[model samples]
Target chain A: MGSATPVDDEAALIAQLRAGDESAYEQVVRTYGGRLLAVTRRIVGSEEDARDIVQDAFLNAFKSVGRFEGNSKLSTWLHRIAVNAALMKLRTRKRKPEQSIETMLPSFLEDGHHEERFKSWDEPVDKALERAETRQLVRAKIDELPDGYRTVLVLRDIEGLDTEETAKMLGLSVNATKIRLHRARQALRTMLAPHFAASGGGKATP
Target chain B: MKCRELADFLMDYVSGELPEEHRAHFELHLSRCRNCHEYLAQYESTVKAGRIACGEMSDELPGDVPEDLVKAVLAARKLDPAK
Candidate 1:
């Protein structure tokens, strides 16, 4: 099929698979396996674990493919399975001890001064890229944030999902997602402020 | 709405989820408030930086994935009846 086809071929492919067409199942796996592996690696943070998770996800998808009602995109359905698998794996691992929410709030409150630190986009992209090392620094800092804030930022900002989509994926209210994203941004700004100041970035434009 | 109130609503505003009337209220307040305006600009920039960082790291994932794993996945799929 050409790239411009109108109807979603995923449903048709699934139908073919159910009808015992082997090529359709292979086509689905070939198309989505890499992407699913990448997402799993990001969530699980290990190549070995990601491989296992992707395999399990594929097995689960194979079993449930018949039950898929064509309501959601196939990619999204596969994504949900991968995410669920990774989260289950995470639960079984030894997690870092939980930090108190009270302690988390004070650090976020102290980040109120974060507005003073960005250079506007008029700067050259090369220069911006050089200065943008703060992104790496900020990601490391994101890892330090409370689990609640970190997960929302990863799902929303990093994964490029919209707030409603993220809320649905994470089982949160829309307002709750907004608040978490806000706090996550504030915390990141606080984390990056020092690097921004060190690089002598221009004051944020009003 | 005051700056604090606007700050409370800014995420919803940027996300474009606020009701039209509330959004209008936010813009009216933003028109008069320099600090909130700067705050919004900075917040947007931070989001932009986060996106760039995520894109860069995500791009790295493909290179890091073992080629053999991809081949194995392809081989496994070839045995499926639907594929």
Candidate 2:
């Protein structure tokens, strides 16, 4: 299954699979299973859950394959299913409302870590490495971003969709997407700054 | 436009979404302002870091995904109505 090649002719495969070719179905599964699993894991943040979600996506895709128009690529159609499945799972979970920034700001100021780090700066190269490491420091920061910011970052940055495509996918105006993306980048920058400074590559400015 | 205004628009500038006149105006401000240049660099790095973080995060699946899970997905497809 791991080494299965992408179907050379997705339309042909879909046509065959629609004609009751079980091998074509298997081929589709083998080609897309790992990637779909990866997308699911990113959204659900659990291997078991991701597996279930991906399986559900495949099942849904199979059930609806005959109705699929050739308007979108087969992979895109499959990924849309995966995204929908992931979003449905995410919806089932309860999430606490975000605290107001005014309430949270004082606690951040009171923290010695923030105070000490913001007091100083670092050289540029060290800053870059530190920024890189911040990716591992918290797994859920992206998930915690405001919904508008999170959606843009996830679609454009994480999912590797371009602005135009992301705009279309999210049903947002391009200007709205740009604003969200800018704010998301800024928010993530603020979160990672201390780590970046500590990594010693950021050039200290007066 | 002031450097402060241009700084706020830096991301759009880098993304090439700014109108030609605005792009020209922003660059004109950038050329003369050291602080804005540095700020722009930091902003660029921040965006780059965000992109890298996303890529790294996506690549890092829990190392212990059970082989059976994939098999189960494959097995489910056998009963697929479309198949």
Candidate 3:
């Protein structure tokens, strides 16, 4: 049903894998390696560690392939494996206490109005982000988020996974996922405000 | 809706998770409230900027993956008992 590889093809590949075909293993690696590495890198925050995690995920998937009854697409299964591998790496890394998100949230007056009004960001964010410098700034800002918030943002906003799937992946409830995602977005907006904000509430002409 | 009320549930509206009645009310408020409308645009811009940042991350993949990674995995496969 409208997939990159046909169901018959996937079935044949799974059969070949189950039969211990070496080429099938190579095919899986070649097909999924780039994307799996990208997903892991965002979570683990290091390209080298991401590579190691992808290798581990592939190995883990191979060991468990027989149990993979094709209830979901192979890529979906592989994506989950990569996510888990990154999480495992995160757990093993030296834990640092994350900074609280309260400091990054927008402030409202007692009367329910913004303490400081946001200036109209006249330049579309996409246009601003198209500049290499702004793109780098955005990435750095994302990295500044606490891991919990950052992971939720990456899964929901970046990877385009639905909230329920993202929640399940993180072992968080849907509500928690939404909360973290919203906070992450808010924090990111705070980080981005300086660049976008006009000094006196006028549009910052790009 | 007041600014505080809209701020409290902004994420729900953006995510399309608010019920139809709530969504209609939220939209009506946006139509009448300039401040909330701008805040909503900023919130949406944050999400857009985040996705663009992520796209850049995926775009930075090396042309060739590390050979060691593939070699190590394949070598380990040869050690598997099932094979």
Candidate 4:
């Protein structure tokens, strides 16, 4: 596979892909396959299906390479294609069982006050997040979120998609997408609370 | 603004999407409430942690393509070269 060149010089790569250059396709695959796999796997929650989705994305990109404009960075374009492929795969399948995030969300009192006090972490937030265990816990909590909320969070947060684009991908209203993203973050925070308790010294109660 | 109101608006406020009309009230409440302060900090941290976790930190790939996947795609392309 050819090494990936800088995006500013990607016109040559684009030209090669447009001409159905085998090496260009190989370079694209080698460069983007793993990132696409991670995204697809997060969305579909299955390694086998995610692999197939990645393949479909590559094939589709190859077929449409002739039409790709240089307006966006090549990586962004490929990421969108991979996300669309994952969303399509999700649409075709029977819905998998998804856990509810309600219990993980915060509770409120009758007077509109919070039912619980959120303690400041004993350690600096950045320092705490740098630990491998903390990162693993975060990923696990994200996986536990219900499908709707998880998809919104993944697309809007991790994938850095705009709200409108996320809604379009998931067939959701913009309002619904925003709400889900908020609740998903809130639920994740609730899940990490004990791990960062002021008294616990950044222990893992999870 | 009440705590529940701030809770609902935290995401928008943090993203700077909250309307200027509501920003003052939101900030005013956030300043006075210890619980909301902690909640907001925790919420922001969770967002950052998840991004780092799912992004480059945890989703790293081997530099070379997987042989099986690359071979399968190459074979498929050869069989249907016209497209």
Candidate 5:
């Protein structure tokens, strides 16, 4: 999607990549590197690790270029590799402590009502998010989510992967994936409530 | 339906997977409850904002991808056995 190759030009690019043309490698890196970095960074939740993961993903892509059937867009292929690399890193780094998703989830009163009243954002959320600070806050809150929830949020919500695909990737059932995604979205909503609520979160950035 | 029960179906509700039989019942609760309606609207907004925030990096070049990182990947291709 990002500039490496339009579907029309993808076959030519794949041939060049397969031929190991130095310029082709350079083009591929320049085209997709930033995008891949973005994908991996969110998943691993670390700048340094994301960089390493992208590098590994690129190396792996080159090694397997011959095997690529061109059945998918070049960006999609690279995206998958980057995602897999990030998930693999996550699996290996399981020793790190993760927060419980329960703490971030919504709390219901005895009558099944919200403990806190819901307030609309100071402005339209999409427009308000135009502020870089607000976006950062959102990213930080997302990173704050426990790995299980964060990954589900990233893949299903951000990456736009299907529920079934996400479930298969995470080795969970579709129902389980949906549950995690819901909890993740709920947790993020709670975390961002203060920042966007009409109580003056709009001025936080301005 | 109580706000909690309605909230419970949010996952399906948002995804449009909530059963047809339950949809009317769900809307009835939303139409009657200001709290639940706001909650659903805000919840949907949250999803949109979250996607935009995370996807912003990839759309903008050099957002966070350092110049050196690109060079390093290219250099690695030569020294590594990928060729």
Candidate 6:
């Protein structure tokens, strides 16, 4: 709970929010809008669309505030709504030919050995990602995943939703969610290997 | 567990979902096998790096989110009756 408000205070705020206090609405937006929009932007990959999704999410939350159980943090609840809104937009969009993940997966030989050698990236990944450029690269590689796998990974790994919640959101079975998430991480690792395995540690000059 | 078997169990191992016996086997394999250990570390790194990137992305709010989002959402709120 990164929220500054005490639990009782948040409960009161939720009451006010449900009662249609305009100020409460503004307060909710001011507090959670940026974070929600950022999540939607990652899922939808567009600022305008992300803004629209956040708007829809807030409107949905406002309309449904009575149902907000307070079992979770308000920010997390809002984050879920935003993720739903983004997924809705994704569903309604025109279909593109789906990208195959085969290219991104690692190749294995007939004898069950890796087709290529993997160099040890003994450096801590958190340290490597701390570099602004490496973080950008990480994001780009995640985006390269196919939508199904990418969404699963984003929800399960990045958004920190449990496998069950992710499966529920994606209309997938728990086993399917697990498989998709594993494949997504493996593919992402393949994409990141060159940069991390390089002796230079992907350090940015600037 | 062999390396190929360990590959299939990687997710379970990392997520702590593997059964105790399987986990022991997986750990034992990692202890002796350099390749599997490196692979496991990189797999963990992929997840760690992904989470970090997403956390950074969440901190990055585009320009429209502050004032415009609030205004638009409030307007929507006004039109709909609160439940």
Q: Compared with the true structure, what per-residue lDDT tens digits does model 5 show for residues B4-83?
A: 88989998999899999989999999999877887798789889988888774423443334679878988888888565
Q: Candidates sorted by DockQ, descending order?
A: 5, 4, 6, 3, 1, 2
lDDT of 3 by residue, B1-83 (tens): 66777877899998777888878778888898787788889999999998886673434442344567767778888886354
| The 10-residue segment with the lowest total lDDT in model 3 chain B | B56-65
lDDT of 2 by residue, A1-206 (tens): 23346578888898887786777766676676766776676666677888888788878887888899999888788888887777667767775674332221211122111221232235553244455345555335665666556667777766677888878766789888887787776675556556555653232232
Q: Candidate 2 or 3, higher TM-score? A: 3
Q: Tens digit of lDDT per residue, candidate 4, span A1-206?
A: 33323345588888988888898777777777777778888888888998888887788778887778879888888889988888877777888676777887777787888877666877766787778787778778887787778889999999899999999989999999898999899888877777888553122122
Model 6 off-target regions past 4 Å? A1-8, A199-206, B56-64, B81-83
Task: Judging by lDDT against the true structure, name the best candidate.
Answer: 5
Candidate 5 TM-score for chain A: 0.89
TM-score of each: 0.70, 0.72, 0.86, 0.90, 0.91, 0.88
For residues A81-190, what per-residue lDDT tens digits would candidate 3 score against the true structure? 89987887887789788889997787767776666566778689888877878877887888888999999998888778899999988889998999899999988888
> Which scores higher on lDDT, 2 or 3?
3
TM-score of chain A of each: 0.67, 0.67, 0.84, 0.88, 0.89, 0.88
Clashes of each: 12, 12, 0, 0, 0, 0
DockQ of each: 0.33, 0.32, 0.49, 0.57, 0.58, 0.55
lDDT of the candidates, in the order given? 0.65, 0.64, 0.79, 0.80, 0.82, 0.80
Report the Cα lDDT for residue B10, model 1: 73
Is 1 or 5 the stronger prediction by DockQ? 5
**Interface RMSD to the true structure, each candidate:** 6.1, 6.5, 4.9, 2.7, 3.2, 3.8
What is the CA-based DockQ of model 1? 0.33
